[model samples]
Each structure stands twice: as structure tokens, then as C-alpha cells.
Target: MAGGLNLGNHDIGVLAETTVPGSVRPGETISERPVDITLTMPELLRESTVTLLGGQAAEGASTDAAITLTTGGQTSTVAIPNLSSPRTDIPQQAGSPWLIPATGTVPAITVPAYAADSVALGMPKDFSIDATIHTKTTTLPAELTCGGPESLDLGSIPVSGDPVTEPTTGPTTPPTDGPTTPPTDGPTAEPTDGPTAEPTAEPTDEPGTIPVELVGSDIVAPGDTLTFSFADEWIAKKVSFELRSKPIDLGTRTVSVSGEASVRIPTDAPEGSHTVRVLSSSGELIASVPIEIEAADASDVDDTDDDYWSDDVLASAGGPGAGIAVLGGVLLLAGVAVMTLRRRAGRS
Candidate 1:
């Protein structure tokens, strides 16, 4: 927001107004931009907003002005264009102030960072916010820093707080009410003739480097192809595929000279975390890639479905209900027999 007490000369430019959340996380800043020599070194400044006020620009003009920003000891200038939308509806008469909104965006400035943190923000007031003409008072602050809520709800971020220690477990006590004396009535046991040797631990095979690189999407529906390329030992060799968790063999394919291969995820593949294992010709396991087969879409099912009385079904069943379907022929035989009897009666 910007209005004027005839700020006829003063320009705007509140320094280092706000901070954006770090690209990956949130943090804190000193925010109180002091007048002392406080442009700290070795920090990152970004996403700062500096607003200018009271400057007059011709409406609908296609002109741009220069704004300089210095940060991390490097200086850069950006062009600020005139606002396309300015409030013209404000009454230009006396007693009313001309409140023009601050418009136009400046690219992320690589300015000096504050508070000695490498990624902190700092402000250098090299530009002018005061009017060259005349104004009763400076309406805006000359310096501002990005400071606010010092923490994030993402677990706990150690912004300005001290580290906390973990709690230790307490000791447990033994049960009472039982006799403390040991029972001596048990039979003596004989020692085994052999010193029971500790069983040799089976050597576990560490995962080998999968020379393969996935070519396409790992997440796919059944019937979609999974493509990947490989190098080294697996090149130009037959590699069998396996769908882990379900133990479905996904067939085998010979790697091309280009070390690439593709396999279709069967339409019957289950919707879950599935591993596509690559194996060598001798059936040694190679690297495995994870894939997700989504549930088959019900809408993809064919609308022309067959039922019990369908032509194909009835033909396969030898007719609807089999022998019971010959009732029509039996009825025709009865009619013929009835007609013969009627003719004999007529003759009589």
C-alpha cells in the first residue's frame, strides 16, 4: 500500500523487506536491519522484495527503470517496468491521498546474506528511497530484514534454539515372593562326546551392481512396456525377468547390441510393489529394478461381454440347457399323433 502527504519528491524502496522459505526448508534471520556495518560475509540472499513509492510513471507507457542490487559482494542491476494496472479511480481532488500499489516483480537478487549463516539474507541500501523534490516526512522505513516465526512443524528445525538431549532408560527390579534357595533334586546330565561346534554362518551374497538403466517409466499398468538398457556382462545375452513378491516369470529376452531390452507388464500383474529382476543366461541374479503395476482400470474392460445364453456360450454348451432344449421337437411329435387320432375319428 502507498499513499502520499504530497510525497512529491520521495521515492520508495524499503530495503530487504521479506524472506522466502529456503528452496528446501525454512529458517530464521536477524530481520532487524541496523544502521551499523552489518553486511555479513559468506551468505546467500534470495527472494527479497524492495518496493518503491511516490515515483510518477506515465500511464500506459512502455518504459523501464533501472534498480541496482548488491549481494555477496557482487552487484547487479535489473529493469523494473511500469505497472500495467494502476488505480485511476482514486479522486484526484484535495484532502485525498494518491494510494498507488507497489507493482512489478524483480528477479531473485543475489545480495549479501545476514547473521553469518551461509544461506541467510542481507540488505544494502545503495538505492534511494527519499524524494529529491520535497515531502513532509519519509513514510516508509529505509531498512527491513526477513524475520518471523523461527521454526517449522517439520519435526524440529534447529534455527535459533539449543540442541536437546535424548532421555535414558531406567533400571528394572527383580521379582520378590519366591524362595531364594536353588533346588538340588534334578538328575545329573551327561556331556556330549563332541564339542558342539558353532555352525558355519552362510555367506550372504551382497547385491551386485546392476549395469542396467531403466529406459521408461517404472510405474505402469499391466500391458504397458518396461524398457531398460544395460552394459558390461549382461550385454547381448539372454536375460530372464521375474516379478518378485508374486513369483511370476516374466519371460526372457536377448539384449540387443545396443544393450537395450523391453518387457511388457502382464495385464494380470498384481497392484503392489513389484521387483523386475534381471538374470543372466546361466540364471545368475543380476540387478533388479522396482516397478509398480497399478490396478487394471475397470473402464478398460470390453463392454460386449458374453453371458450363459450368448451365441458362443450356447454353441459351446450344445444348446441352452442341453437335452432339455429338445422339448420343442417332442411337442411337434405329440401334435402329429393327436392329428392322426382326429383323422381316424373323422373316418369312423
Candidate 2:
């Protein structure tokens, strides 16, 4: 172990245990014990007259944000320095030795290190390595500090009472029931003023006219006159009668007490059911009756049809002149026989 008092080109001061010598077995073996090294330095040292010419130190902290370092009753507040610069050299004041003994027994010796919950350097390892070579990377304060002036004494202060709210006259209580009557301030309706409309008269049916219906039997002979009676013929004159397309104007006549009327069926009218309509002067249908005419018998009229002489009839009759001659010969024979009888009677 070599203790160095470095202040020249290397550093202001450095103490390291470069190697440790001991006996070991021939085979590869792990050492279970850690070698402890003690480091000592003066409390103060003079600045070197040999001017150290090199790159400048890293810039100070970019932020004024205060950081707290606390160890037991001591606490310190400081701003974290900027780490972007190429150099970081913090000369530590020599005081108590921060003894970093290797933890327990290990397979091999490792560099001793010190860590505490109260202290942390924000600078990264590469930043510290790139920093200007110095005796120490971190500086130790004379004592630990924290917070603004009196932050550590916060727990001593008593919790204050709940804030008292002042009373006010503003309306906060809800009404027990809603307001009663409807508001009368709304607009009023105005009455309409214009011409009064006249009431229309109801239509009345004309008197002296009534619904008429024809009543009669269903059958009528060929030349027979068809009689039809009205059921409700009310006061009308000159009702024109129609049988199919033929019209029989019953000129001007009042309805009889029996309300009966007659129209003749023509002899030549084809026998079938004929619709008879009685229309009033106003062209309104007063009555309708269906009359069926019986078919005329064939023998009812003179048979003017002659029998047609076919060839067979003519042959049976010996034609025309032969039949006439045969009739004449018979007549002559009958006359001669009468004369012979008369002669015979006379002789007797």
C-alpha cells in the first residue's frame, strides 16, 4: 500500500491500495477475507505554486433548486451542480475518515464504498470520470444541513382549529311550500268583431209528388192489354209509358181512384218479358213493371203456307196431264153404266 501526497500533474492528493500479497493454493481459489486499508491526510494544504494548466472545471448548477442533506440532527441545503461540463473537481476538507469497509467476507477484494440515505451526488459516473482529475470527486461539508432555516422543527407546531365561517344574511333556507295563485300579469285575449253570418234554411221536398211503384201479375197474353196499378202515385198527370224502346204517351189524364193504367201489347211483339217504365213529366221514373207475354199459337192465324210438291208427290199423282186424263175416263165409264141400267130396266 502506497500513500500518495499528490499535488502536481496527477492530483492534489490521492490514497489507494493498489495490491495485496498473500499465499494461495495452486488451483484457482476464492479468498473469503477482505483486506482493510487506512487512508490519512492533512486537515489543510497549501495551494500548489506549479500552476495546473488544463481544461476548466464543469459549470456550476444550472438550477437554483435547493437540495437537502441530512444526517441525524445536522442538515444542509445546496443546489445540484450541472453535469454536462467535462470537468468536476471538489476538494474535500479533511476531517473524519469516511471509513468504507468491504461488506462481510467476499470471494475477492473490491474497492470500498460509502453510501448513506442522507447524502447523494446527482452527478453521473461518466461525468465524474470526464471531470478534471482531482484528489476527490465529492466534497464533504463541515456539518449536514437541510430545508429552509426552520423546516426540521415542523412537527412541533400544533394543528390549528377548523376555520370558523362567518355568518351572513343571504337567503339560504328553502321555502316549505310553493307559491299559491297563478300570476295575473299574463296577456288578456281580445274579442273578435266582424260581420255576423246568416243562417241557411233547410231544404224541403216539393209536395204533389211522391214515389210510385207498379204492381201487376207476371204474365199476359200475346194481344192482351197489360194493366198496372200504382202503389203510391201522388198527384201527377201525363205519365209517359214505355215498353222497351216503344213509347205510348198517355196524353193528359189524371190518375184514377184505383190508380190503374193499361197499355196494349202489339200483336207482332216478340213474346218475352218486357220492361215497362212509367216516367213523369219531369222525366223521373215513377214506376217499373216486368210483363211476360205468352207466345202466340201457330194455328191462331190462317195457314197461308202451301204444301211443297216434291218429286215423290208428283210421281204419285201421275204428274199433271196424266192424272187429269184418268179422272175423265172414269167419269165416262160411270155415265155408260148408268145408261145400260136404264135400258135393262125398261125391258123388264
Candidate 3:
């Protein structure tokens, strides 16, 4: 009966307690027996190559038994082997162990059933076992389903509630109301009257004798005192005084020998019928007068002051000095024909 089971770092003992003597004896005089013992430390004895188990020995009696181990302060012994009992009920080879390597001071095996059966068997009983090793977990690959062919033409794509057209052939329906009725055979008719026959009067070119006149045949409206006397045969030749109108030629002058000339009409000149030609010092086609030009009449100033005299001397003296008395009666009949030819040549 030794006692001390601390186990905080080892200290335990319960070395022996035997029973199994008469096997099931429940009578006569063995009333002080109580053998329900248990002790264990094997997780294979935390191996160093271990094996130890022992218990039945009674035939010749010396069946070995001892087990002690201490780690880190080194102490170890184990030898508990020997067993044989089970005559005809077969089930006994239970004692075989022997690991001994402790030389002198052994005392550290405390296996109060390896700490009460590893705390009632949840398992680690003093463990330090090792060897499951294994390793392989990596995986990842497999994925291919297979898809491709929809390159395009998704039903001509326009579908989001479609409706958008606007082209029924070129410039669409806007040209209908035309050609109302304007071709009744093109240029109708409504013009006829019969006598437009007076345009046949074309015999004009008759204007030559411009024997000069207009020293004032009537003018005044910002007037310019006119003059122009010609006709002694255009005053002996160096003549050049133009001023025609009927299709204008209005200017040119240079004829002087008392052929007395002048011209001024341009108070913006155009009052109508005008002509004044007389050209000749080689510019020939000599004469034209036709005057009219109206617009000015302060009582016409008596024909612009009788145009200053010589109407061919008042038509050969029908008025001014009677034209010198008809030129002295034609020189008195040329002296009475030279006195009758000198009396007929003195009667020859």
C-alpha cells in the first residue's frame, strides 16, 4: 500500500493489487476484497520501439514484472512478460514485453492509467507518437463547354419597336396638281383693225438750200443771240457751219466773210424740229434749214427782232430803200443803149 498520485509533472504509484484466486467465490470468508483496478500508459508506450504487458503467473511462480520510465532525466526499464492460464475456455496468451535501458536509479513511470486512462479515454495518454505524413492537395483545370457561330446577321437588326421608313421612289408624292388647262392651242387671238397703211411716206431727202437764216427766228429761254447770214454763194467758199438735227450733227463752224455766222441753241437744245446744214469747203452737200424749236414766247419778241434785216434786202426792195430804187433803174437802161449806138455809127 504505497500512496501519492500527483501527476503534475509526474509522481504516481499503484504497483500491485491481485485477485482471481478462487474465481467467483461469493461465500465462506473472504469479505474484505475489492479488486477493480486499472492502469495504462500505452499509446504504444510513447515508443522507442515499445511493448510491455504482464499479469498471469501461478504455476511455478516467477513471472517477471516491472516498468518505469522518466524522460529528459533519463531513466527507463520495462519487463513484464509471462502468462498462462485458461484450460478449456481458450483466450489467454496475454503477457509479453521487454524494453530495458536504465542502469541505476529508476523512478519516474507514473502511469496512473496514464493519467486516469488519458482522462477516461479521450486519448492522448502521454503521447508523442508521429507518422501520418501524407501531402497532395492541388487541383484546378477542366473547363470547355464549346461555343462559336453567330458572326452576324442577327435577323438584320432593327428591332426596338421598329417603324421608320421614308422613301417610296425618288422625290416622293408632292407633284400632283399641275397642268391646270393653259394650252388651248397656245397664243389665242384678238388683234385686227385694217388701216395702219400710212407708214408709206418715205420720200424724204429734200433739204439743200439752206441759204442761211436764223439770226433769230425766235429764241429766248436763257437765249444766246443767234446769227448766221450766208448765201452770197456761201460768201465765197471757206464755208463750214453745220448744226443739223433730224438725227443730230449739231456742230462745226468757220465761214465768215460777212457770211456772218453764229450759233448758240444749247439751252439744252432739244425742243423739236431742227436742221441747219450749209457745209461746203469740201464738206459739200451744201444746205438745210427747217427750224421749229418752240418753248419760249414772251410775246415772241416780234420774231426775235425781225432777224436783223436782209431778207434778201426785203425781197429785192419791196421795202428797204426799195432796194436802192431797183438798182437805179437798171442803170437807166444802160444809158439808153449808149445813146442809141452813137446815132447808128454817125450814119456810116
Candidate 4:
């Protein structure tokens, strides 16, 4: 049988001895006595226990013993618990010895080895085992180095402790030579007489006027042509056109004495009452008209009529009857002349 046993730090040994009584011839009258065997480890003489088995008490005998071996204080004993048939081959028992402490101290049991039986028996190995212990400590001083000069000495330096002298009566006072100086009187200020007058703002003159008229009294539709005529003579420098209802400024254009200005109504203008104002360059109010710009529809038709007339024509037509009065005066003069001639003839 092939087996192994595990042992501790204590020493151990196996001893075997054979003793026979008065020996007799073999196969004749004979008496054979069983031999006693003991296993010991002297280094484990302290309080330790050991278990033994598988070895025969006598070779070629039918007797065997299993014993628990213990040692204490230079003495050891073996107690046989069971018996079995003996054999020449020894079957090893696998166990570990108890750790014994120093002579007077209690034995300290170390942690079991992590190696398997095959490793412990010197089989081929691939790995290693390691144990480690760690410790840490810290120390601090009562006072710390804050890093600066501690004290300043102004030795043998003269310092005045007396109260500062102040001027009892003077126009101006002097300053002191300490951290807080005496407040001196400021310079005397001259007084003013009365409230000053403010400049007045001049009035602005109003701008010149420009007369305008719409072509018709009806609403103007989108894509419809609008004719703007001047009621008075046109002056290019003084007149400007603006869509007052909208923020559009249709630039000014010069026209003839009896001419008209035509502009296409913008398509984006809203369909509602809109006002167009003619303003002077000086921003004076001149003339304005509220025109209705209608939306395009099937019923909307383009109508043209004599909606505007020239001021020159109107003034000429409304003048006094000069020709008729002139003819009446000539006929009266002729009647008077004929009467005078007839009287002269009668007298002749």
C-alpha cells in the first residue's frame, strides 16, 4: 500500500522490534509472541495528540493495532482502539501535528497549509503559496510651523505720548503726525447773487403746402390705375407723396401745370379705407384724401369719367361778362352819336 502522513514541526520516528519466548522447532511444538511497536516524535513532547494506524504489530501475523499517541512533559503513551489483520505493506495516515508553543507558553496552532495531498507528497508542482502581514503607524506634533516672523522690536526709538497741540484761534489748522490726522478747515467759498436766466427756444416755421385730388369719388381696387392731379401749380422741390395709412413713401415727381400723376394700386394693400397725404419737405400738413381700395372681384369694372377739372379752366369760366358789357356800351355810344348828327342836320 502507498500512502502518506502529514506531520507538524515536532520530530517523529517509528520503531519496530520483535521478541520471541523460548523458541521451538518450526512445524513442531512452537510458541510465537506478538511484537509491540511504538511511533514517537520527541519534539512534540508538549501537550500534543497523534493518530496511528495501518502498520502491523508483528510481521506475517493476523494482529494489527490503531493507536492514538499523546505526549506531555517528557512522557508519551499509546492507546490501541481497534485491531485488524496484519500485512507487510504499511498504509499511511494523512494528518497534521498540533503546534506546540514555547516551553511555558500555550501551543499556538498555525493555519493549515493550503497545499493538496498530491503537492504535499512531492508530486509535480505548478503553483506557489505565499503569506504576508502588514502594519501601519502615524505620529503628529503638538505645534505646527505656520511660517512667519513672530515679534517686532522698535527698541530705543522715541515716541511722543503727549496730546497733539491744536490751534486755539486761526484761519486754518495744521495736520497731526499720527494715523488719524486733525481735520483742517476747507477753503472759504464765495456766494452767488441770484438765479440765472435760461435761453429761450425759437419757434420753427411750418412747411409749404401742396394740393392733391383723387381722380374719382369711388373706391380704387387693386391693379386699378389711380390718377392724382394737382389743384394748384406743381413745384417739384416743395411737394412729396406718402401713403399715410401705410408706411410707404412714393417719391415726389414733377408734373405740368395741367398734368396728372398716375400710379398702379399695389396688390398687397389691404382692402379698406386708406388715406394718402401730401406733405411738404418741411413736414407741414398740406392735403389728404381717404380712398377705399377694394378687392378684385368679377363685378368690379373700370369706370372713367370727368372727375377732375383744371383750376385755370374753372377760374376762366367763372369770370365777369366783359364782352357783353362792352357791346352794350358801344351801342349806346352809337345811338347818342346818331341823335347828335340828326339834330345838327335839322338845325342846318
Structural similarity to truth (TM-score) of each candidate: 0.27, 0.23, 0.17, 0.24
TM-score pick, better of 1 and 4: 1
Write down the TM-score for model 1: 0.27
Deviation of model 4 at 121, angstroms: 99
Superposition-based RMSD of candidate 4 using all C-alpha atoms, in angstroms: 66.1
Best by lDDT: 1
Best by the TM-score measure: 1
Better of 2 and 4 by TM-score: 4
Ranking by TM-score: 1, 4, 2, 3
lDDT of 3 at 178: 75
User: In candidate 1, which residue pairs get closer than 3 Å at backbone N, Cα or C atoms, i.e. clash?
Assistant: 9-131, 10-131, 12-53, 71-111, 71-112, 72-112
Number of clashes found in candidate 4: 3
Model 3 residue 156 distance off true place after TM-score fit, in angstroms: 99
Segments of candidate 2 deviating more than 4 angstroms: 1-215, 232-236, 245-253, 297-348
Tens digits of per-residue lDDT, candidate 2, 37-120, equal 121212221111011212112211111222233333444443222212222332333343222111112234211122122222
Give the per-residue lDDT of model 3 (tens digit) for 138-256: 11111110111122111110112222334586775677687857668755866668765666577667666657675656433423445667765554233444445545443444334
**Compared with the true structure, what per-residue lDDT tens digits does model 1 show for residues 104-190?**
444443323321222323222211111111112222211111111122111111122322334797659767678788776876787
Best-to-worst order by lDDT is: 1, 2, 4, 3
Clashes of each: 6, 8, 1, 3
For residue 133, model 3's alpha carbon misses the true position, in angstroms, by 99
In model 2, the clashing pairs are 6-12, 75-144, 75-145, 75-146, 76-144, 76-145, 76-146, 87-131
Question: Which segments of model 1 are wrong by more than 4 Å?
Answer: 1-210, 298-348
Off by over 4 Å in 4: 1-210, 235-238, 298-348
